[model samples]
Target chain A: MEWETVIGLETHAQLSTRSKIFSGASTAFGAAPNTQACAVDLALPGVLPVMNRGAVERALRFGLAVGATINARSVFARKNYFYPDLPKGYQISQYELPIVAGGSLRIVIGDREKIVHLTRAHLEEDAGKSLHEDFHGMSGIDLNRAGTPLLEIVSEPEMRSAEEAVAYAKALHALVRWIDICDGNMQEGSFRCDANVSVRPLGSDKLGTRCEIKNLNSFRFLERAIDFEVRRQIEVIEDGGHIVLETRLYDPDRDETRSMRSKEEAHDYRYFPDPDLPPLVVSEAWREAVRAALPELPAAMCERFINDYGVSEYDARLLISSRDFASYFEAAAQRLIELNPAQLGNEEEARRNYGLAIAKGMSGLLAAQLNRAELDIAHAPVSAAQFAVLHARMIQEVVTSKSAREILLALWESPQTDESAIDAIIEAKGLKQVGDADELGGIVDGVLAANARQVADYRSGKEKAFNSLVGQVMKATGGKANPKLVQEILKRKLEG
Target chain B: MIPYCADNFASIERMAISLVDVKRVAHLARLEIDPAEAEQACERLRGIFGLIEAMQAVPTDGVEPMAHAQEMALRLRADQVTEADGRELFQAIAPQVEDGLYLVPKVIE
Candidate 1:
């Protein structure tokens, strides 16, 4: 029987606020284990939680970005559970009515675009950590993360494959960072994903019982966990066994999932509306305030890159993947346009092709270097103006395309504030293009004297022999000869 | 036709509380209730439920359920960093502590 995989993700994104959601304690990571925990975070008796206005505003900003419905009134409910990390027996979270409702995120699957619909996003306080090692078989608890604000974004089960699930996650990760809501740092546990995966026969209306794979921190792991779970379900069904609904943990070392707890042992949260806190009421004016503060989102910027910048869909997506890269592209493109105003004339085709050239250099060449250096566009060694200068020189035939790569490497090794520094490297390394016709013509004469058999081959209609002769000419000049001028001079002398 | 609702008081009195129910509720709340005292605890809970039953007898038709006794506006605090971290003071009260972490019986990862 054919199988189809179904996936839904729940992501907990830590808000990038200065203080915890309810208390004024610092949310900075890696503080001495419990140093950041305050009375309110530790859930000391008689302490009331004052809602952090910054946390609420960040939620509103995210709602506006995704075009979700912002509920005017939402209630905070107590989710009761017992765990060592939970200082309060009950966690305060939104249950029936969340702040944001019914939005969709666009993810690229292969070459086609697909929308992963979101069920809801709610504001909640994160629990503290349970440190299990270095204690002689006893576990330790760190309450530093106890009151950190988190936006739990839940998605509908619209993803059909592990690949689709990963794409949706990557797009959402980029967006959270782009809007400055969360750092989207998986390493520090700022952003975490839980995937609900199930498998059923193809074209079946009923979804198979799902086992949630929890706390997958990296995208590669999320995909692997889902794929492994899907295969496990198919094998179980094939062996005449029913899948048990449970909560499982993905063991990255073993590359498989193991049952953490079965449904029968799951906690009955005994949810109730908390009496201490009143129902959260958001006014129209407040939503508008947050809307005014939001930056231009990634989807809109991606469309503009395609329409205004005239690049391919793939390249446009790549350029706008990060906010910094999009800004860098705009600055470099503007510089290129200013350097040559003639390209902006009535020839619209030429203008677009010229834009494509600049796009290729920025997205392909510069992006590769940034990835190798493990630096973001914000901290790249080569400034936008310097890159623009190097690109312009290559297009103007001042430096060969091969020399441009060398200059980029040199710039990365010893960076400068000015683009004119490239001129010094070119002169010192003798990479200046020898485009003078008189100088190149003398070298062509020396090549013709050495290879008479190759010259005979070209006269007899062997086109490859002519390329060999051209290679010799470039080799004699130490690859500094202008390729276009070399081709012209070589053709002229060979014919004579 | 005989107005059976008039005898609601008698029906409330007949409602029974069992020791088993008491034990289950205590276990769910993570309390270790002794079996010897389960009967007394059950009787006390029944008294509380009896009062709720009497209140339930009151006709609440056309009345909306209220979450709180009095309607009050929620107070909002400004989003600002106002508290200095007091990590040591908080950790000092834990049962056991090592390297700023609160130690407890080991749990599976």
Candidate 2:
């Protein structure tokens, strides 16, 4: 039976602020258990919670970035629950009215863009950590993270499959980092997701019963958990069993989502507005300031790459994976044309190929080198201008693609930040390619005479023999001959 | 039907609270209540619920829910870590502590 999988993600992105959401305690990770937990963080007597301007600003920034409506007034509510980590016995969160409402995020899956509508994004305070191991019949509570600011972005049940769900999660992950709101780190519990998964019969208007899979921080785990839950739901329905509306935990080791809640233990968090803090009022002027200060989003930048560089949509998407990579590509492409206005003149097509060449290099050998060296593009020894210099040499046909790799390896080992370093390396290694047909005619003719039988085999319409003939010419030229020019010259002489 | 009503005080269908509810709520609040305490708590809560139901019958749908006594916007503070380390001083009052962590009864999921 065909089943339509439905998934909506509730992502909790920890705002990258120095202080806790409502307290003056440090929100930094990796501290002693309670060193950062101050009196306000622990909800000590006579201490009231104060709102952080940085956290509210981040929420405003996110609302603007996703094109959401920033509510003029939002309120904080207290979610009452019992946990050792929750020092105050109530977590301050937004209940009815959230800071951001009604936004859309565009996710690209296999070159098709799907807009996942966001229900709302609210600001709240995070709970502490509970370490159960090594404590005899007790859980050790670390209140260091008790009051950190978290922006919970909820999406509508618009996704149809696990792949689309993962794509949406990744796009949201990149977005929070792109807009500089959250650190987007998954390991230290920075950006995490809770997926509400269900499956209904295809083309059904009514929704199916959903089970919330909680605390999936990794992308692969999100995909797997949703898939496992979907399969389990389908199997249950097929076996004459009804789907239980409950919360589940995804066990990555076993690759299954186990039901974590029983009907008797269902949560009924008696929520009420927090009386300590007043309503948060976002003024018009403040919203406009946050909007003006917003960075260039990925989708808009992808469109810019396509329009400005004349690159395809595929290449455009690849270039804007991260902010650093996108900026580096733009700088390098623009610098390439600036460094060589005459050689790579204002011919629209030639300038366009510069973007393509840089992208190709980045996607190919340069990517491998950087990955092997374990260096991010920001810390990559090869600067954008230096990369432009290498491509400036290539676009002029001074060095072939084969020798280009050798020069790139040298640059990787010992970065040369100067403009003339490329030329110095080329000159020192004598790696210039012979693109002039007249200069390479003697070498091609000598190779053809030395390998007459192979030439005859090529004239008899054997394609492999033609390749061997080209190989001999390349061997004679010590592999410095431009492969494209060599192929063009060989085809021309063989026809003549 | 409302997922989360802004005004929690605006609605209760003369909410009937039994001794079971009192005990459950007491457990949730981490309050130890005896049988007499539970009976007294139920009677008092019933009276409060009756008064709340009278307020619930009055339709104030358009009226804004007042979260605080004051209507002023929340005061925003700068995102600075102004608090110094007082973990030892604070933990001195805890019932149990191991390696600077607050210990509680074991909670398993």
Candidate 3:
């Protein structure tokens, strides 16, 4: 029997607030245990939580970015449960009322676009970390993370496959980083996901039992966990065994999920409106201020790249992966247009090709070099201005593709930032392409004279002999001659 | 819980806080109650529920329910890091700690 997977994600993104959500405690990571946990974070008697204005502002930024409804008034609720790491005994969160509601994200997986609907995003506090290793049969707790501000983004169960789920996760991750709300650092536990996965018969409307997979920090792990969980559920149902609803933990090393707790062991949570906090009210002016502060989102920037720059959708998407890359591309493109405004209008083909070349170089060559060194666009060794000059040189037929690759490597090693640096490199290394038609035609004539048999074979209408003549001309020029121009010269001298 | 029937006031008063219910509440709260004090606890609970029952009996069909008694907005604090490290001072009061971490019974990951 065919089965369809349904998945929802509950992600906790730690907001980049300077202080704890409801305390004056520092929210800096890697602090010593209990060092940053103040009286309020420690939940001492008589200490009340004061709402962090910065946390609310960051949440508003996210809501506006997603085009979600920012509630004018939302209430904090006390989610009561007992865990050793929870010093407050109850996590203060939004229950019935959330700050942002009913947003949707457009995600592109392969050639298909899917909309991942968001249920809500609410503000909450983080629990302390529990270190279960190296304690000699005892556990250690670090409360430095206690009360850190978090935005719990809950998504509807609209995703159908692991690939689509990963795409949604990536888009959400990029959006959070683009808006500067959260760092989206999975390794530091700044952003984490809990996937609720289940499988139903292909055409059935009835939902199947789901087990919540907890704390998938990385995208790869999120995909693997969902895949394993989906297969497990389908197999159990196919073998006439019903899946038990539970909370499960994904074991990455073992490549499977294990039940953390069965339904019988689940805690009630006992949610009730927090008595200490009043309704969190946002004025219309504040929402307007936040909306004004938001940067042009990735989706909008992507459309602009395609419409204005005339690049492929894939290229536009790649350019907008990070703000740094987008800004770099814009800077280089602006410089390119400024340098060749008159000539660009003369040849429509050249203008279109120049746009494509910029996108390709920015996304392909630049991306590969950055990935090889484990560096991001922010830390790129070559500045955008310097890269723009190099690209201009290539587009003007001053450097061949082979020499351009070599020049890029040399640029990485050098600290030269001026346009003259490129000229100096071309002069010093003698890597200039020979694009003069007269000079390349002479080289082609000499090659045809030396390879008489091959030239005769070409004159007899042998197509392969023409390529041989072009190769001979390139070899005779010591690979410095432009291959495209050489092939044009070879074709003209032979065929014409 | 089912709403109090208008005609079942006597039955409602009788079952407002039963001794068994009082014992169960105490157990769930992790508090041990002496057998002799069970009736006292039940009586006090019954009085509290009796007042609540009376309040519910009053017609509130059209009254708007409020989340809190006061209609005040929550105060917002600036998002600033103002606290300094005080690990030793905080850890001094802990029951057990080692290597700057609060020690507890072993927890499985």
Top candidate by lDDT: 2
Screening candidate 2 with a backbone cut-off below 3 angstroms (N, C-alpha, C), the clashing residue pairs are none
Off by over 4 Å in 3: A346-354, A445-453, A475-478, A492-496, B1-43, B58-64
- DockQ of prediction 1: 0.37
Note the Cα lDDT for every prediction shown. Answer: 0.85, 0.88, 0.85
Docking class of 1: acceptable
TM-score of chain B of 1: 0.75
lDDT of 3 by residue, A1-496 (tens): 8899999999999999889999888988886678888878777789999999999999999999988999998888888766778888899999877899989899999988988889999999999989998888888998889899999999999999999889999999999999999999999999999999999999998888889999999999999999999989988988999998899999999999999987553455657678899889999999999999999999999998887778999999999998988988888776776666236664445445666677889877888899988989888878777777788887778887677777888888875768678768888999899889999888888888899999889788888998887777877766778888888878888778
- Candidate 2 residue-wise lDDT, A1-496, digit = tens: 7899888899999999999999999988899789999998888899999999999999999999999999998989998888889888899999887899999999988968799999999999999999999988889999999999999999999999899989999999998998898999999999999999888999998899999999998999999999899999999999999998899999999999998985454477777778898899999999999899998889899988888778788778878888998999988888887776346556576568788778888878777888899988989888888888888888778887778888888888898778688888899998998888898988888887788898788888888998888888887877789888888888888889
All candidates: DockQ: 0.37, 0.65, 0.46
In candidate 3, the residue pairs with backbone N, CA or C atoms under 3 Å apart (3 or more residues apart, or in different chains) clash, namely: none
Error of 3 at A111 (Å): 0.5
- Chain A TM-score for model 1, please? 0.95
Question: Candidate 1 lDDT, tens digit per residue, A51-114?
Answer: 9888888888888888899998777778887788998988998877688998989999889889
